[model samples]
Target: MTGSTTRLFAARLAGTSVFDPQGDQVGRVRDVVGMIRARGPVRVIGLVVEVPGRRRVFVPMTRVTSIDTGQVITTGLVNMRRFEQRGTETLLLAELLDRTVELADGSGPATIEDLGLDAVRSRDWQLTRLFVRRGTAPRGLAGRLRRRGDTLTIDVDAVVGGVLGLASPDADQGATNLLAAFEELKPTDLAEVIHELTPKRRREVAAALDDERLADVLEELPEDDQIEILSALEGGRAAHVLEEMQPDDAADLISELPAEQAERLMALMDPEEAEPVRRLLAYDDYTAGGLMTTDPVVLAPDATVAEALAHVRRSELNVPLATAVYVCRPPLETPTGRYLGTAHLQRLLREPPQTALGQLLDNDIDPLAPDETLQAVTRQLAAYNLVSLPVVDEDGHLLGAVTADDVLDHLLPEDWRDADEDDDLEGTSGKEAAGA
Candidate 1:
């Protein structure tokens, strides 16, 4: 059955059984599980098999031999007595089940209901994990819903009933239908669907998505989509999404665009909003300096709580929503400012505003050279858990700044390295491959 249905919908495998070579029933498949790596499709690693009248067993895919419509085939024909009943250890299930999984086609979230496994061409065969629909069903369900506009609310009892051949009686059928429909969506169409959603809806969709699928959709999006979606968000919502994106990416989206348009969007945003973007705009778009932002929270070491509060109020207009405040002296002999340490915002807020900034200063802030590569900057930011890193010239003068978001944009799927490699390869070929 696995060979006959190489592309079977994962949701339809909920009730599928597993068997050994001698046609002996082993266990019923409970869930399919694996991690999605950077190199390929989701790799299936094991199956959570529940044997009737017995405990559950986590059968590694290495034990699978083949698959068919009614049952999965395994390598050894062991007796039912030989099967070990493992306790309810959901480690395997937890690894693969109940995750906020996404459909590769539409990049939408679909709950995993169970896993299906079969061994074919290899000793270990990881089967695909089944996905069930939950939460508020997608809109326009008249043609899509199982009962024509009826929402399918998933619960533990409902899931158990569906697997045990009770309840709605058509749950598997409904899931299969939904999976097929989702598979039909093109990448561009998926992006468009995401784009039309409201900010909350967009976040839901993004959160439901896996990183690679999200990256694929992001790669295909037009520049406008990038800017509009990003500009509308703030804090972790904006940061997480952008973090998954490449630095040059977020930069490119904001670069060369109308300054007034960006300004308008920033004006409407809170300090967190206007700051990161404004920092990016400060860069040259073509140079590293042009790609940086300067919205990190800054402080003078001698500032008191009252003074800090005053600074917060005054600088609130330009400062990024920051986790730490940097302490620095104004530029002495250079155009840019000298290097300093940092202070925690939480600490400052907890103290009286009149507290001195110097006492609060943490003097251990990591600083970045303006010319550092985006990759280097990303590593530093991650190491410090910083929201933004200061960029300075060799003389310890501040140039601008680079936010975590900027680093993320550059790290995304823009193919800068590949493009360079291709250019180098073409140069080496020197009309040989071209002539051929």
Candidate 2:
């Protein structure tokens, strides 16, 4: 227990491995449990650790012996029970990262980027410093040309002195810091972070993301989360986000809402953008039509290999959707003129740039019918060794394309997204190790 006072940033501690004195890993840190007071600094209570089964357990600060950049060392027997939040407990990452607070210098409100915890004694730790940012961080061109915001660490007591520490549940908070921290994460990873937050905070964070970004995250979330977050947005904004999502995804989400609510949102959406979603909604949820994406790469039969390559090169296109370019007669959009055939990317690359896509079409495989069952779609993809397949109507017009990912999503267990949320262990607080 005798060592220089240890200081660790909450962000650094997050996800760091926790180990026993014998060098055996116990679990990874999910979050820091702290006690926020009406005055003074927040006291570090324990660490929320996720074990092998995704069960969260508490390891008190009293048991911690070492804090390093990559790992935490603890003494005594570790508690294995589920870590439930007490009335006085706060999850630093889940509740405080994006909180907007007034600075003591009167320079304006700042967003908390990270927090620093210091060991006050062998068994006591306290939140002592706040890493925060202030100023508008405009995105796109402006973000690239200019600096984001002034970030610095200040005494935790500065803002916690009075009633200005963390904002209330309903208070308007900026997600700049939190979003910045998660900027490099994939949509699925970001969805996991958002899934752990409280509903109100989740709504605030969702509101801060742009329509396209929100659409990406929403697609990766569970059905209930998608419904909740979408319902919380203003009608127009919600419609815009839906428009950014894949037509099939947007249709599925809309179908889950109450009829009146769904109608209202669809009405707010641009008619041109809502058309494809509306079309998909007419089909059964488990059918090829419902699972197909209307925005897959499409090209006219006469399009050159170069043009087909260009369409597949779009940065926004997902891998499966970009794997092949559907070559149709005229009216290249979904429900396209004639379902000619698909020109795979590999084939396109092998052809001369000036060669027409129609010459490279792979029509040997039959396209899927809109009414085809999800199981049938899966079988087709597997049997054909294809990443995506075209969906055509009875009239031989292309409706959309069903990708491997879409089929896998439906075939997986319904609670697959909730795999990390399982909390079967029941208990209040976990017991400390056997000995001091």
Q: Which lDDT values do the candidates have, in the order given?
A: 0.48, 0.79
Off by over 4 Å in 2: 1-5, 11-31, 37-41, 45-88, 100-113, 120-125, 131-154, 160-170, 420-436
What TM-score does each of the candidates earn?
A: 0.33, 0.78
19-91, model 2: which lDDT tens digit per residue?
Answer: 7767777777778888877776678988887665455678888778878668887774566655667888888
The C-alpha local distance difference test score for the whole of candidate 2 amounts to 0.79
lDDT of 1 by residue, 103-149 (tens): 44443445444444434345444333354554323332221333222
Clash pairs detected, candidate 2? 77-433, 77-434
- Number of the top candidate by TM-score? 2
Q: Could you give me the TM-score of model 2 versus the true structure?
A: 0.78
lDDT of 1 at 334: 22
Highest lDDT among the candidates is held by which one? Answer: 2
Query: How many residue pairs in model 2 have overlapping backbones?
Result: 2
